[model samples]
Target: MSRRKKTSPAEDVVDLIALLPWYVGVILALAGYLLLHRIAIAPLPSALGPGALGNAMVGTMGRGLATAGQYIVPIFCLAGAAISAWRRHARRSLMDNVARSDGPDILDDMSWREFEILVGEGFRLQGYQVAENFEAGPDDGIDLTLRKNGEKYLVQCKQWRAFKVGVPVVRELYGVMAAEGAAGGFVVTSGRFTPEAEAFASGRNLRLLDGPQLHRLLKQARGSSSAKPAADIRATEQASNAAPQAAKTAAPSCPRCAQPMVRRTARKGVNAGQEFWGCSSYPRCRGTA
Candidate 1:
């Protein structure tokens, strides 16, 4: 059995903290006030009379804490409002494409994060409520879980540029579908699929989308975003931000599907160690340069 890598607790704590919005501070402050009053300030008040005892060390500390807690409310409210506004702004910035139905070839010049956004946008266009699992690691392959018509659907995005996706990948997705009891499943790729993979999906409740089909889906999505021609994509990216080193390298495309090819080495046979560009749609498309 393989050992699972343990997640770092510190990282988990940081992620948890990030999810707690600023509004929570109000409740925390209120709780602090109650605690301070009970511990040091309440005894004197419960005696039902003003007295010199209120000047005691514990009493002073409690009074100070209680006073500080009073300010926490207004401070929390202001901070919460500001944080809420900033969150809305950041969320809107990232989801700018979610409301648009047309755009460029998403896969052509996108990072993995962008690919997930594109997938969610596509499903949203179809009226499905999308739930993303972008943070899932190798242990969890679910990328997008969608719901509509009282049925659940699981989608996996594979922005593979090289080698046609093979049958095993499709099979694994099928297993996930079964485990989730999903009504159906979709395996979307920026390239194509192998023949064996296609054959396995022939009679199943699974939809396999190759690059070209995915392109059309984006174009026809209801909200209709304006499509940016492929050439403009790179230019737009350049104008918007500095391109990364990886982006500078123009990877070769798969001749069969016109999808980007990934470098691979032969693992068996005489060509085993040779590096070459394989069709990202692997077993489905054996197209090679």
Candidate 2:
């Protein structure tokens, strides 16, 4: 397939507008054409003095520009609306693919841009308004911005082949979240996080999702009821805030080292489909419950 070409300044404006609802672009297109057409056709005042010559010339220039812009601006807006409609369709198609798939392996084969789109679609299915990052910049670390319950949340996606996300990645997201005053943040990977990364995220309102967790989240979201009211998101936040404490009180201790165990699902071997508690100090202590 052919790759998309680099966008020009005018195309960039169209894309930025495309990020809004598709109908909004259509409305802007209509409004822009009408306003510019009015300006283009307005009658020029008769020059009464020598100084009025410059004003007439300026008005003539304005009308000339407006004459062309009446068409040009609306074309740009309409193009944006077309792009917005295409993206909405793509997102829905992406979600449908995931819903039909059997496992998370489908995610591993996708390009980074496709992965980001999939992630954004997954969030949208969960009732969040998701905005994608189309360009790179200093704060472009955020792959997706999600809004629900009038609260902002940032997300950073790692489609890493290395299969292990570390503390520094989580730390950077936390710093950005703090700087931006986001309600929370999520670090999602098509792989697993290092123990230190998980430790740092605890109680920070930063949810970390490794491969399996993300798969389950998307699957559940697809199966769940359509986007709930804003109050549902708030209730989810309350439940998430209370989860750590509940886990602390309820988790079983490791049989070998006495450390707390984390609930984990078996991915291979005789117990491939089972859920069990495994030692948090894994690799060092191979205890299970």
Winning candidate number (TM-score): 2
* Every candidate's CA RMSD: 24.4, 19.2
The C-alpha lDDT values of all candidates are: 0.68, 0.86
State the TM-score for model 2: 0.72
Candidate 2 lDDT over 193-262, as tens digits, reads 9999999999889999887888788877866744456659989999998999886669889989999999
TM-score of each: 0.49, 0.72
Candidate 1 lDDT score relative to the true structure: 0.68
Candidate 2 lDDT score relative to the true structure: 0.86
Error of 2 at 100 (Å): 0.5
Each model's number of backbone clashes? 23, 0
Q: Show where candidate 2 strays beyond 4 Å.
A: 1-8, 46-50, 226-289
lDDT by residue for model 1 (1-289), tens: 0123437653443333333454554455456556654554455444434565646656767677766665554454445445544544544444454344353454656666566667776787678988756243473457888999999998888888776888888898899999989999999887889999999999999999987788777656632443436547978887766656556655778877898776778899998899777788888888775
